[model samples]
Target: MQQPVRIAPSILSADFANLGAEVRAVDAAGADYIHIDVMDGHFVPNLTIGPMVVQALRPHSAKVFDVHLMISPVDNFVTAFAKAGADIITVHPEAGAHTHRTLQLIRSLGKKAGVALNPATPVSVLDYIMDDVDMILVMSVNPGFGGQSFINSQKDKIRAIRQRIDAVTAGTSRVIDLEVDGGINAEMAPVAISAGADVLVAGTATFQGGPEAYADNIRRLRGPLV
Candidate 1:
């Protein structure tokens, strides 16, 4: 069954100086998950928030903190993020040498483990470790920065992963969320949804009109179905 589309407004584009208030605003505006992008300069060319910031933002809302770690040797930091209140921690396959071990660590921490697939990375990466994952993030643009144009090619990847997720769910009770990040706005949102993406990570689109327009932005991203 196709799940209803969910909007996860990325905090990368939120006001840096007032992250707490921004988180509160989005939560009040009806955001499903608080998407937090963590970047390391070595892995993604830009550096963003860390565990402390995540901890700070934790008190602002009761929403799930969907933390995406764009850092290499990712296993070393999974515990910290999980401790800091990340309900879902997403790691890229390229970030660590032992993807399966890394995922196991995240799960062991009592938090949901997610795998993020970059544009060049193949969907087959999930073949061996699908059972260990709770969510699959299909990046529609490169991971380093935000506000990039949507890469239309990724829709194919979304469909492929969607089929794979369905195959897994058919037998077991595993329900993996197919989330699409990068360049997610009102325009490309429906395109991703048609390809079977249930969750969207919107950065600039969610923060463009400031806190007041957050509800409308998220509604637009979710389309008429909501």
Candidate 2:
């Protein structure tokens, strides 16, 4: 059976002061996962949340905590986030010297592992680790900040990666979620979906009008993919 499309609201653009309430609001608004972007300034020129914050927000919602680490030296922080209640941990392959080891560490900690490819990073890097992860995150825009424009060229790349994941996981019970982050909105939802993305990550588009608008925004973002 095909997996249902998911709308994950990125909290990078949410109100940080009331984070727990914000998380609950989004979960109530129908978010499949709560996407937390962890930046270390050194990796992408911006700094954001840590495990302490994640641990605090864990009880606010039972939705999947999709943690995307945009920090360098990714391996050093895997354990911390995993213990902080992150259900899914994703790291950029270029962020560490040993990508395979990082994935292993995440899985060893009992969390779903994922590898995120930047807009310029080719899918070939996943050749050996394709089956090692539970998800493939395609950055539709460069990581760092929220509300960036989507890279048009990534549509084909998304399709290519989806095809590759299918090929590698053939005849197995393994299911790799294909997620696209950055610049995702209702209008672009179908594009990403048709290109084979099952999860859509949006920040500004999701939290723009505050919690009250979340339901309609998420509804529009889900489009006809239900």
Candidate 3:
């Protein structure tokens, strides 16, 4: 059976003072996963939360902790984040020298391994590692910051990755999830979903409004059920 699309609210856009409450609110608001963007100043141009923050929010979240690591030398920190409670750990393909090893490390640590492709990165980078990962994160906007406009060009990228995943895992029950991050809102989400995305990562779109609005926003983004 085809699974329903999942909405992951990025905590980067949440109020830090009451992060726990914000996380719980979004979970209650119907977020399938709590998306955390972990950025190191060197990797992306900004610095954001680290494993400690994820550990703190872990107790408040009953949903999956989808952690996206936008930091350089990601290999050194995979275990730390996993121990801190990341259910799904994603690392950018461009962040390290050994991408496959990093994905394996995340898996070895007992978390779902994911690979992310930057806006400018091609879909072919995932070819060799496709079978090993649980999800592929396509950045529709540049990383580091939230609320940026969606790069509509990524629609084709998402479809291409989805096709590749489908081709490789044809006879197996194992399925690779196609996830789109950046600039996802109620209006843009349907476009991504129609293009074959199984997971939608929304930051500003969820936090721009209050909790109730955030929950309503997720429903609106999902659109009418087929």
| TM-scores for every predicted model | 0.98, 0.98, 0.97
- Over 1-226, each residue of candidate 1 has an lDDT whose tens digit, in order, gives 7779888999999999999999999999999999999998989999998999999899999999999999988988899999999999999999999999999999888999999999999998998999899999999998899989999899999999999999989966668999999889899999999999999999999999998899988889999777
Per-residue lDDT of candidate 2, residues 1-226 (tens digit): 2488998999999999999999999999999999999999999989999999999999999999999999989998999999999999999999999999999999999999999999999988988998689999999999998889999999999999988878877888879999999889988889999899999999888898888999999999989766
For each predicted model, how many residue pairs clash, with residues at least 3 apart or on different chains? 0, 0, 0
Please identify which of the two predictions, 2 or 3, would achieve the higher lDDT against the true structure: 2
Runs in model 1 deviating more than 4 A are: none
lDDT of 3: 0.89
Off by over 4 Å in 2: none
Candidate 1 C-alpha error for residue 109, in Å = 0.7
Please give the distance, in angstroms, between residue 52's alpha carbon in candidate 2 and its true position after superposition: 0.4
What residue pairs are clashing in model 1? none
Query: Which ten-residue region of model 1 has the weakest summed lDDT?
Result: 166-175
CA-lDDT, candidates in order: 0.93, 0.93, 0.89
In what order do the candidates fall by TM-score, top score first? 1, 2, 3
lDDT computed for candidate 2: 0.93
Question: Candidate 2's error at 61, in angstroms?
Answer: 0.6
